[model samples]
Structures are given as C-alpha cells and as structure tokens.
Target: MDALDDLDLRVSGCRACPRLVDWREEVARTKRAAFADQTYWGRPVPGFGPPDARLLIIGLAPAAHGGNRTGRMFTGDRSGDVLYQALYDVGLASQPTSVAADDGLELYGVRVTAPVHCAPPENKPTPGERETCRPWLVQELRLLRPTVRAVVVLGAFGWQATLPALAEAGWRVPRPRPAFGHGVRVGIDRSEGSVGGGGPAGLDLFGCFHVSQRNTFTGKLTPAMLREVLSTAARAAGLGK
Candidate 1:
C-alpha cells in the first residue's frame, strides 16, 4: 500500500487518547436518534482527497454525528453542507453535497483533514487531547508537503494547529506566526523534503471562517464569502485553470 493509505490505516486504529476513544465508541454504540439504524465509524477519521492534491484544507475535528458516523471528513453535517457547496462553486469539488463516503463526491485538487481525528465531547477536544492528536497531523503534512501549494485553515483552532504541524513537517514557519482572520494569508518557506525536493520555495496559507451551523445560520459565513476565499486559494494552488 502507499504511504498515505498505510498512514490512514494506522490513524483509524489509534486509541491513544482515552477520553476520545471512549467517547467515540460510546456515541457509536448508543447512536443518535435520527441515525439509530446506521452504523458509525467509531474511530479516528482519516484525511480524504487525491494523493497529488495541491490544495489542503484543515478543519477543527470530526463532528460527533458527521465524520464520526460517516467516516469521512466534512460529510453528513451542516458544516459540511456549507463547505462542500463552496468548494463546488469554486470548481474544487465535483459535487456540492457530501452525504456519505460512497456518495461519489470528489475533490479535484484538494484534501480535507483535521487537527483532531476523533470526535470530542461538546465538539471540543481538550488541550491535552489536541496535543496527543498532533503527531498524526504532523505525519500527514510530511506526506503532503511536497504537492501542497496552498492550505486553507477553517478556523482559529485549525490555524493554531496547522502552523505547528507545518513546522514539524519541515516547513519554516515565521517566528511570530501571523494571526488568524478571515481572508488572512501567510507564506512559509518549504524545506528540502517537500515534493519537488528542489525548486519550489514556499507554500501559501489562507484562513476562512469555520462553516459551522453557528456561522452559516448567523450569516457570519455566507456561500459567497467562502467561495471568494476558496477560489483565491485554488488559484494560488494552481487549480481551477
């Protein structure tokens, strides 16, 4: 198997965080009222996208009823509804909706991952849990660094998590790292281990508001707002020609 596939297998089997492991399993066993008939993934969710993707999207974590149930990042949730539509509008996704893993929704030049793989209680992972989950993200970035030209961080949490992971994956992040804000952009020097291994000098990072229900329902994040950010990043990543 390829490195990405092997890493995904390892990620799926991880039970390093006791709290996360228990919570995820319990949720799966109990099942949500609306999804009681469906089986849950009940484990660490792996990143999804083409192996050669140039656009990387970093989200906070799997939603309890979304990824934790569907086993695909950003699937089966309101947040995903907003996100996938924007990606579709910008020509990144083949379809505007991602209802399930086998629904045939495809991302053309992008990959989606999260800092925390497992769903957390109250939709928030504790600081210790976030730290424990860091290694997986660090390793994933190491694998993607070469091909990834641009990264879109979905929220401040993802922003904070990605900067360190990028550094650990050998990117030279700025010392004072730029603050996160909607449409914020930062450039970081890529190291020798990157995909091209020689010429490409840097990677661009873009920040966007999280597509959570709170944001979408409150008008804090609209389709046009998200499309603008994604389209710009996609262009920077050399996608959507």
Candidate 2:
C-alpha cells in the first residue's frame, strides 16, 4: 500500500484518546433515529482525496452523525452538503453532494481533512484531544508536502491546529501567526527566518468560515461566498480557474 493509504489505516485504527474512543463507539451503538438501519463507521475518519492533490482543505473534527457515520471527511452532513456543493461549483469536485463513502463522488486536485479525526462530543474536541490527535495530522501533512501548494482552512479551530502541523511538516509559519478571518490569505515559505511572503515554492493559506449549519442557516456564509473562496484557493493551487 502507498504511504498515504497506510497512514489512513493507522489513523482509522487510532484509539489513543479514551473519551473519544468511548464516545464514538457509544454513538455508533445508539444509532441516530433517522439512520437507525444504517451501520456507522464508528472509527476515526481519514483524509479523502488523491495523494498528489495540490490543494488541501482543513476542517474541524468530524461530525457525530456525519464523518463518524460515513467514514469520510465532510460526508453525511449539512456541512458537507454546503462544502461539496461549493467545491463542485468551482470544478474541484465531481458532484455537489457527499452522502456516503462509496457514493461515487470525487474531488479534483483537492483533499478534505481535519485536525481531529474522531467525532467529538458537541463537535468540540478538547485541547488535550486535539494535541493527542495531532501526530496523525502532522504525518499527513508531511506526506502531502511535495504536492500540496495551497490550503483552505475552515473555521478558527482548524486554523489554529493547522499552523503548528504545517510548521512541523516543513513550512515556515509566520511568527505572531496569521489571524483567522474569512477571505484572509497568508503565504508561507519552505524555509524559516524570513517571512516576506509569496515565495515561488511556498504554500498559500486561505481562511474561510466553516460550512456549518450555524453559519449557513444564519447566512453568515452564503453559497457565493463559499464558492469564491474555493475558486480562489483552487487557482492558487494551480488547478486552473
């Protein structure tokens, strides 16, 4: 198996965090009423996309009834619905809907992942949990570094988590760090010490509001806004407009 595939297998088998392990298994057993007949994946979700993807999208932890149930990042939830649709509109995804792992949907030049793989209670992973789960992200970043040139981070949590992982994976993250805000973009170089920006081989980091029900339902993040962000990031990743 390829390194990315092997890493994914390891990630899915992770049971390092006691609370997450118990909670994920419990949620699987209880089974949401709407999906009672369906079998939950009940394991940590892994990054989904081609290993040579030039663009990467980072999100918060998987949703309890979403990735935790479907075994794919950003699948089986309203958030995924919003995200995949935007990706499709921008030509980054084959379809606008991501309902299940084997649904035949595909991403073009893009990969979707998260800082935390497990479904945290209330969608909030504790600080300790994030730290415990970070090695997996670090390893994934290292593996993707050769081709990944741009990143779109959804939400403040992902932004905070990704910077450290990026630094550890060989990028020179700016000091005082870049703040998280919709439409914010920061350039990161492969070497440390200098932080001018827009280096030829550097990575571009774009910030976007999370595609959560809260943001979408309140119109804080509209379809047009999401598409704009995805399109801009895709272009920066050399995926064409």
Candidate 3:
C-alpha cells in the first residue's frame, strides 16, 4: 500500500517529460470539443498490479484512445485486449477483457506499466522523451523491490529501458544473446532482493515483439508467439501450473 500510494501521488501532476506533456496537452485541448467532459488525465499513468508482484510487464507509451483515455495502463486498446486475453489464459488475469476502467480486470501477480505515461503524438516518442520518462521507471522499480522475479519486456525499447536497472542491480548478460524475438529468454544474476532476507536471485527477462498492429498485422507477433513468451516468463517466475 505504501508504494502504491506514493506512486499515485507521483503520477498525478507529473511534468518530468516536457515534450510528452506539451504534446499530450495539445492533443487533449484540440480535441476538447469531443472529450472536454471526459476528464483527460494527461498525467503520468501508474503501474497496476500487486505490491509484491512477481511479474513485470513493460510496454511503450499509452495510445490516444487506449490508456490515455481509460486512465489505466494498457486499457481501451487492441494491444491491451490481446495482452489481457493472454494473461487470462496463463491464469494471471481473471478477465479476458481490459477495454475500460469498469472492465473489472484483476492481475494475480502481474503488473503492467508503460515506458512513457503520456500518449505521444502518432504513438512514437522521441529519444529525448524516453530519457525524460526514465526517472519514473527507476522510481517504480525501486518501489517494486523484492517481489520481482522476471521482467517481460514487450519490445526493443522496453528491453532497453529495463537493462540498466538490471545492470546496476548486478545482473549480467550472456555472450551471443539473441536480439528480441518471440519467446526469447535471458537469465540475469541480480542483487535487488529476495523474498524476505536480502540476497541474490536470478531475474529472468523474456522478450517479444510488441503486440502493436505493425507486428500483429505482419504476423511478427501472434497469440502463439506471445503465449510462448508468457509461458517462459511464468516458468521462470515459479508461477507454472
């Protein structure tokens, strides 16, 4: 509750990334006629899951009508719909739907969050924007301390953002590790924390092509592809059924 409470406050009026803030606000303003009464929360979106979550799902920025509209990470988007369905299949999520705030979705031990909170114009965030958005991620990781067993990065950028934290926490990569693809897993030696007593544990990082239209339409990512990654992460996190 402590960490979640702090994150809620931190995300309320976030201005860490000026470019994203300005762009998000502009988009909200220009489309105000239609969404004015909708209460656009053009602020940092917080992670959703358990305080002692064992799995971390990393994604890119929110979409215009996705998390940006629903105010919950990954909600109200095609990507989220697919993701939640997969999580439901793996026994992590109770609902196969994540369409809106009232979807009543619940994650067992999985947390979902985006690299960038504010939805960028055209869904592409600049490198400067990514840099500006890094701090919140760092803070989030710190608060998530002991329970994280593996991080399932949804794309290249998500992997990149998570790598440094893994490194500083004493994680190491093996030689000839392949680039991100569906069902790729890399185990890292980490010193973040253990269940209770402070100790070292291996953090498994699984990578998959994002569930975006670009990948899904091209068949680069499919339900089978994503499910493989999910199974791998679950096995690593000791959540296997």
Best by lDDT: 2
What's each prediction's TM-score?
0.95, 0.95, 0.88
**What ranges in model 3 sit over 4 Å off?**
32-37, 169-178, 192-200
Report the lDDT tens digits of candidate 3 across residue range 1-241.
4866687678757887777788777765565455566766556677888877888899988877677777788887788888988888888898899977777888988889877788888899877777677777766765665677888999998777777655544445554544776567777765544433564456788888898988888888888888878877977787745
- The whole-model C-alpha lDDT of candidate 1 against the native structure comes to 0.91
Instruction: State which candidate, 1 or 3, has the greater TM-score.
Output: 1
Q: Which ten residues in a row have the lowest lDDT in candidate 1?
A: 192-201
Q: What is the per-residue lDDT of model 2 for residues 6-105, given as tens digits with 9 covering 90 to 100? A: 9999999999998999999999999899999999999999999999999999999999999999999999999999999999998989998999999999
lDDT of 2: 0.91
For candidate 2, report its TM-score.
Answer: 0.95
RMSD of each: 1.8, 3.2, 2.9
Least lDDT summed over 10 consecutive residues: which range in candidate 2? 192-201
Candidates by lDDT, descending order: 2, 1, 3
Superposed model 2: Cα runs more than 4 Å off: 192-200
Query: Given candidate 2, what's the lDDT at residue 6?
Result: 100
Report lDDT (CA) for all predictions.
0.91, 0.91, 0.76
Q: Please, what are the lDDT tens digits per residue for candidate 1 over residues 100-150?
A: 999999999899999999999999888788888999999888787668899
Error of 1 at 110 (Å): 0.5
Error of 1 at 95 (Å): 0.8
Model 1 Cα shift for residue 26 (angstroms): 0.8
